[model samples]
Target: MDILMIVPASLLVFILGASIGSFINVVVYRLPAGLSVLWPPSRCPHCLNQLKAYDNVPVLGWLWLRGRCRYCKNKIAARYPVVEAVTGIIFVLVFLLFKVSILTIGYWAFCSWLLALSLIDLDTMTLPNQLTQSGLVLGLIFQIVIGFFPEGSSVGAIKHLMMGIVGAVLGLWLFDAIALLGSIALGKTAMGAGDAKLAAMMGAWLGWKYLLLAGFMACAVGALVGGVAIALSQRRFGQKIPFGPFLALGAAIALFGGEAILSVYQGLFFPVT
Candidate 1:
């Protein structure tokens, strides 16, 4: 691609992605709270004042307003701008990777949904069925439809989709088992149902093998982070910690880097081919 083409495309991705991220923020905040995403225009959480168009302009609006509600002057959470900026950055990266391919579009959609679910799970310690179950089903259906499409000559595509289904089921069951074992061992619930559902959703996108990789990464990261937290806080063991966010981070990593990780693993351990 020419430099001019690249520049324009990059700008478009940044602008559009940030705008979509603003809507995603609404989804994350409202869906868990049982508020309708479409109906009832954007409003201040504190004053319930309906936001004007100018007030809803993604990160710019937040910056312009100094992170306060226009009507109520209540301080808005910094998370809004951060989320928008993060999503915009992710959009640019994905565009660079796939360069207008359908895969880029699919992953973009997937990431937006996951971002909302991850934040909600972090805040509420509960994954709304709407996000978890709906994502699971939708991800599977997307894979199935894509896998069976066009000439149907690509047996590999079909295999991938089947693997996704198998992976989803196995991931769900494995998480359930782990949760059960953790509950019994700890005398308390260690994992939430939402975490299992999110894993299934990831499996639907990444296939069972990648899902396993994701689980391993999640466990490793969670252990490291939890240990650090314990040491920093000087807290005793058995303290409650949310696992869903760590799982989400792992899932994102697996989604983007699973093939690379697998390549490294194979090079170091398998090395035959």
Candidate 2:
């Protein structure tokens, strides 16, 4: 399709991603506090005033208002708009790769939850069970539903669902075992319980092979980052760094091309591994 012809479609996708990112901001704040995300509308964090519709228009709203609350004129964190923009970019990139398909929509939902969990983990140093558990279920649902679409086959749907189940089980088991073994080896807490759940969620969505690839990627990246933190003296040698962000990045990469990346690694990149 011509780029001009898909302009409207692309715009719609961007808008959808940005809007969801705004909602993810709410979930990140409220979910950890045991607060209802849907009960209250968007409000100014400083003033507690309900935001007007125009003020809640994601990135544009923040830009229009100069990143300030309309009621109290308090400066808003630039992270809000940055989150919205990043989400829009992620969605656009995924769309460009996969176009419109059941699997693409599944990837969108997967990425959406992944972003929410990652931001929440960054803020709290903990991952909420709400997102990780729900993600596991949603992943299975996507596989099943995608299989039963009008153009899809029931047998294929069942097969995918079974594979999804295996992936989920292996994901949960593998990560949890890693955490347990690491803790025993290090004589301290090595990984949070939530990290295992997160791995399970990714496995449910992407299958076991991709999930393993993501795990490898996460560990390599996390080690590099943790090393940098220690060397910079920003973190103590034994200090714990939240691993969710690294895992989320790995999952996103796997969603795009885990197999190709694995091939590259096996062929010309990291032959020793």
Whole-model lDDT per candidate? 0.84, 0.90
Q: Model 1, range 115-196, lDDT digits (tens) per residue?
A: 8887887788777788777777777766766676655646756776787789789889999999999999999987888788
Backbone clash numbers for all candidates listed: 0, 0
Per-residue lDDT of 1-273 in model 2, one digit per residue for the tens?
A: 688857888888899989988998899989999999997889987889998899899899999999888888899999998899889888888888888887778888999999999999999999999899999999999989977886679997898898888888998899899999999988999999999999999989988889999898899999999999889999987788889999999998888888788888788966765
Runs in model 2 deviating more than 4 A are 266-273
**Against the true structure, what is every candidate's RMSD?**
1.8, 2.5
Which residue runs of candidate 1 sit more than 4 Å off their true CA positions? 149-158, 234-236
TM-score of 1: 0.93
Residue pairs whose backbone atoms clash in candidate 2: none
Error of 2 at 45 (Å): 1.5
Question: So what's the TM-score on candidate 2?
Answer: 0.94
RMSD of 1: 1.8
